[model samples]
Target chain A: MSFFIAHTVHDALTALSDGARPVAGGSDLVVGARHGKAPLPPHLVAIDRIAELREVHHTDSGVIIGALVTHHDIEMHALLTTSYAGLADGSALVGSPSTRNVGTLGGNVMNASPAMDTGSPLLVLGAEVELQSLRGTRRLGIAELWTGPGRTCAEPDELCVAVHLPAPAPNSNSAYLRLEYRRAMEIAVVGAAAAVTLAADGSISAVRVALTAVAPTIIEVVGLVGGTVADVAAAAAAAASEQATPISDQRASDRYRRHTVGVMAGRAVQAAARRAGGEMIPVPLNRAVGIGAAS
Target chain B: MAIGWWPSFSVPSGAYVKIDGDGSGQIITGAQECGTGAVMTLRQLAADEVGLRADDFELVYQDTSVAPYDMGATGSQTLFNNGRAVVAAAAQVAEQLRALAAQHLEANAADIVLADGVASVAGTPSASVTIAELAAQAAGGELLIGHGSGAPPAPPTTVGSTCVGDVGMAAWVAPQFSCHAVRVKLDRDTGVTRVLQVSAAHDSGTIINRVGAEGQVQGAVLMGIGQALTEGTTYDDQARQRNPALLEYKLQTCADAPTVDISFIEIATPDAGPRGAKGLAEAPNVATPAAISNALAQLVGHPVRRLPMTAERVWLSMQPAEPEVAG
Candidate 1:
């Protein structure tokens, strides 16, 4: 049977220091019950009741997103809209309202699926994560924390506390596009996010293309292509689908998933560049269109 | 029930009438309605016999344990076959009452006529007495009670044994077709098809209740549409179903069902059925799946065979160009 325990803790950090797993909302954890992949820790800790970790505050350095803050909260946050537009969009498409209302940001990152939506946009925003244990607290880069799907670099007793995203530069924005089948409730088969900044000389300055579900981890294609409206979309698609290893399963064949990643990557690049409107673009997911096509 | 002619009117009391001790009269069974109009037809038969108004009398159809045994109602046969028995019984009871009136009035039997539940004595309006009055005088003698049955001819000269011959329905299955029209929409990217409209035309052969016939037709259409778009227990190459959980095994939700309109053209088929009614339940849903698939083909650019044209299957059929949108 799947074991469940819920209680407020006197010392939140110490409760999890003895190999206890902390749960805010069991979205991905419960889904693993069917496959029998879930490991039931002898001791369970409920951290949502702790008032100290439930606040979202902004600082001169960056924005501090409370680990308990849900996808719904982040989607409507004004600070992230103009600065981290793609992250907000990605959060909106996580799942239906029911899943979003209960699923927390810390749980999503800790679960660490290759197909995770929030991962790519967070990566594009240059985000860092905080993990706490009885010993103390240590900050780790998002890239360093994720080892692979369902396998994180954090120790068994460690719990992710907060995620910090650095504010974007002037005249810069990002966008995310998810391709799926249905309307209200659906998982992204492939997702791509890009941020483009334009220069004063009327040419591309910076670009970043982040892709999910194409590989074992969320990928950021930095120099896949140049940041011009002409090349942004196509370039991202090619780069995202490249250097990816996916196998065929019941959902779809491996070939279709790769092709989808390429298309979405290109579309994401175009979207990010459009938002930049002539500033330094961090990353641009360029679309191929007719750039390399035979006339 | 279809009322057929009663040929065996050999008993002098073959015509019909039901007389009550009181002015009120009860219609004996001249026909069996089953679920149709048997009650109304029998009431009409009795009201005319006793000169009472049609709406004035109430009916009671007791089982064989209390009421007289009947040949049983089936085929459109109740009114024609068993009607003769009840009609003859009522007429016999009337005849017996008239005979007693003639004896009591000291008049010839021919001169005694029944009018308004009474014999017209001396052909004068004020001189009449009720049938109950005459029956009361003849109470010590035989009480008037008539009982008989009706039957079609047995095997005689020109006939052959066939399919319906065993159950007497051989000439019945003349073959028929129910027509349906459907409209649907298809999403090009995902291959998801939506049902917009469904209309059906059927012939339930002389429908007694319009509401009942239409309900059956609509129910069948909904079942067919669900089967065409989604349903069936599938197994993989290793005989394992990938969707063993209830969430994965998709069924039609209430939101998915479309509106249905059913129309009927009742052909007078007295020969086809006992009361000109034929089997309609099975025929309605028979060809619906094929019709839906044809509609989907128009929405999409190809024919969809096999059931449950799911999103994945539809996506496979309409593959993306270059596998990417922008690039």
Candidate 2:
């Protein structure tokens, strides 16, 4: 019932300290309220207008995307589209145009939907979320943020401020792929993201693989980070299939999710290896891979 | 058509038309226009029969007490059945108007030809009176009203209980046929599929409203694509709908719509109600899913025997090994 538009990071934290729920974009929160998915809090702090939270600037360490940075912003950002292409691919596949324009990355990371398009890519990119409160601030790896579907570990008084992604090394690039029945505005039935570093000989020097909609959380697959492209692809696919603990639901059966997750993981690795070799695979791998029209 | 007595039925449609002091008329039918253009079609039929421009007649509907009984707008019955009622009622009204005009012109009612809201002697074009003049004279106590009811003709007694021999029974008032073809692109790696384009051909007897009928097919094909790929209800373990909201139920967006090409073959069937026009409301939706599925089967060289044929399902169908092998 009460509202405040925070103009700065300090003002947002001040409102949060008063138990006002910080709302950036409110795409998820408003939808949840409309559908009665969750009770609307009595007090709301509008953090979308906070100048600092809308920043998308490179730091000495890496790229910093403010919490208010929208999915559309990430999809069209010059630097992220080039360096963190996997995340950009994931961003491009998020919801639809209106959703991408209004749905912020902070809401996606904090809402913690299991089928989120950006989760697996962020995991592969080694992204971290910065949570601020009146008490102080803390950073947690993307993988450590989720407790379950629509649940996150951050305290109610803590507000997500930004996402930090360490820059990719030379000769490294990444890709994300998701299985959708339609071309636009879909939750991934199953998805995979791979960040690959290619050696001069065109073999995968290192890689990190993550699977979405396969488990309670976005899961990282190991042991395929260092191998030839073919070898890494096969291992990542096998590992993802073995590790996936999906449950049967209407979107997909557990068996189908497990199998397709493996396929996507392998394809993600293949695409990432190609990108690492200096091929410019576009974001939203579906459009480039025959599922949608090319730009 | 074979002669077998199937249960033949008629849909009761009621309509009332009022010719005002002005040259215009008003048609009141109980049919609801749920975006199928029933009101527009009714207006066109009534206007043509009453010898007025389509824009001169306005239509009002859905006031049950004020308007006559109509068998609602479902089953594509609005145009075929209610359309008959309006035309018949307006035809009667036109007859009366011609009779009045004939009296004034010193001609027979049969010799008076009605066109452009004017009643004139067929041979003597100058001997004519505008509908507005006659309507004004008939106002007050002599209100000009037209009423009509329409239904399908009864079946012949020879129609047996069962369709016998090689003959197909034609029990309904109108029969329709349609075909749909779709082109799709399948991503083998991610199991994602997008409908690139769709073409639909329809034989809905006669075409009454060309634009309305074509728009019907276009909308139906898009909805069919949703049913074939993304639209479904999910239930929780407790027998509750899990994804009751539109956000989760996954209806197709504008971006998901494919290029649509529509064609109509107007073959006049005698029993197609009033205007040789058949009911085509649900016809376009009937064959789309099967067409899309067949296209996918041809694309992947595998049977797509599932509703929605999601990328996960298509991908799993393509895999030779089972998930237990990985487990």
Candidate 3:
């Protein structure tokens, strides 16, 4: 019923305290409302014009990505594509070119869809969501922020300001892969993301794996540690399949998702290990590994 | 790959060709232009008979009050039927031009040749007069207008078969044939099939418009791929359609298009449409789904046996059979 355009983070946080929902790109909110999934919120504040929230700043610890940074920017940024290639892979495959241009990482993180392309990659990278309000600011682990499907733990008066990612270990890289029927404008039937750190002997010193579209929220695979690349990849596959609690829907059956997520986890680990060993696999491992179509 | 589709017969089309005093022409017909360029090809047919460039003519079509009656664009018969009528009408104008030229050149009417905007005696290029000048002379007395409705060809006879409830579709006039060979890569883990390359061969008689015909084949093959893998309607137990919207019913996009190689088997038949050309629009659409289905079957060791072999269906087909338990 009412709309406000915020010029600064303080303005956006003040509007949020006044029962206004913050909208950066509105790719999910507008599209879902148009499809009769839900009605638009009565009071809305547009925060896309805030310049401070649209930056990707490098910190001594890692990197700080503003909430309004779009998928197009993240996918094309030199630092993100080189050091944080897995996140780039997820961002590049978000939607069609037009959707990627308008859809932001902040909106994706706040919407908290279990099937979101960026969720698994951010989880595997040990990212944290920074929520700000008129009172103060607080940072929560990415896993803790997502409570359930389409539900987040952040209060109504809080706005997601930035996402903080810790620097990866030396000789470490990440990769994300999804089971998609088409190359563009698709949702992942099942997907996996892996972050692998290689030891001096070309073995996996540490690794983390996460699954998408197989549970209420993006869930990470546990009990994976130092081992050969093959052993870690196999273990990640088994753990992902055992941990995922996917449901049956029109996109895919639960059985199919359970099986394919395992396959995707193994492939993601292998791709991450290859990237860690100085092999230049492309940004999206899907096309490079011949998953979707032949280019 | 598969081959199919027969051209519909006994559909009549009529046209009128009028030549102005300035040698420019107009073709009036009721054929519809539906992005296939079938109606546009009529100008080429008229130009071949009138001895002018295809661009020299203006077309007035798809209006019943001004143009002649046409069977409309359906069953891929717009080109097959309207093309013959256009050629017949243009031939009448050509005959009139030759007669007029014979009078000026003092030659036989049969020996008059029309070429390059001029009418001349068959063996003497020097004995020639421009068609525009002849049209100017004719405009003083006689108006140049020709109308024709070419009779539809009879349907092909059947040899040993007698139908019980024949609705006149049991026999075809000029049957079109095609084969589409598609190479697809399937991910066994996810049951996703991606078409890599397509080689489509069609036998639709002489290809009148090469580029337009090739485009039809390419577009149809993409549609076929959607039908094979993604397009389908789901129904619930109460006979209600579940996925009625496009968001649920998936259609392939340009990103999903494969590299298509098209070839035409040009067979000029004596008893078909104009210049032995048959219907081509719908012929290319018949074999694509089958070609993709066959490729998937070869990979899965058995047919999925569904309209659109979705990833779930293909995965279900590949599952091992359950063991029998002792009672």
lDDT of 3 at B162: 59
lDDT per residue, candidate 3, B1-327, as tens digits? 666565556678999987889888888988877766765588888877877777778788545867888878777777788888998999999899888999999999899988888999988999999988888877886776788789888765655555722444433667777888889888887778898998988878888888788887888788788888888888777978778887678888888898999989998664678888877776666788888888888988877788788877777778888221110
Residue A12 C-alpha lDDT in model 1: 60
The local distance difference test score of each candidate is: 0.61, 0.81, 0.86
Candidate 3 chain A, run of 10 with poorest lDDT: A286-295
Colliding residue pairs in candidate 3: none
CAPRI quality of model 3: medium
**TM-score of each model, paired residue for residue:** 0.57, 0.88, 0.88
Residue by residue across B1-327, what tens digits does model 2's lDDT show?
001111112467889988988777889888788987886788888887767888888887556888988878676677777887888888888887888888889999999888888878999999999888888877854677899986555533455466542133434435667777788877776466778888888877678788988888878888887788777776666879877777667777787878889878788765666677767666777788778888888878977667777666677778776432110
- What does candidate 1's lDDT look like per residue over B258-300, in tens digits? 6877777678643332244444544556667777777767666
> For model 3, how does the per-residue alpha-carbon lDDT over A200-271 read when each residue is reduced to its tens digit?
999999999999999999999988887999899998999989999999777887778898999999999999
How far in Å is the alpha carbon of A81 misplaced in model 1? Answer: 4.8
Best by lDDT, which number?
A: 3
What TM-score does chain B alone reach in each candidate, compared with the true chain B?
0.47, 0.87, 0.87
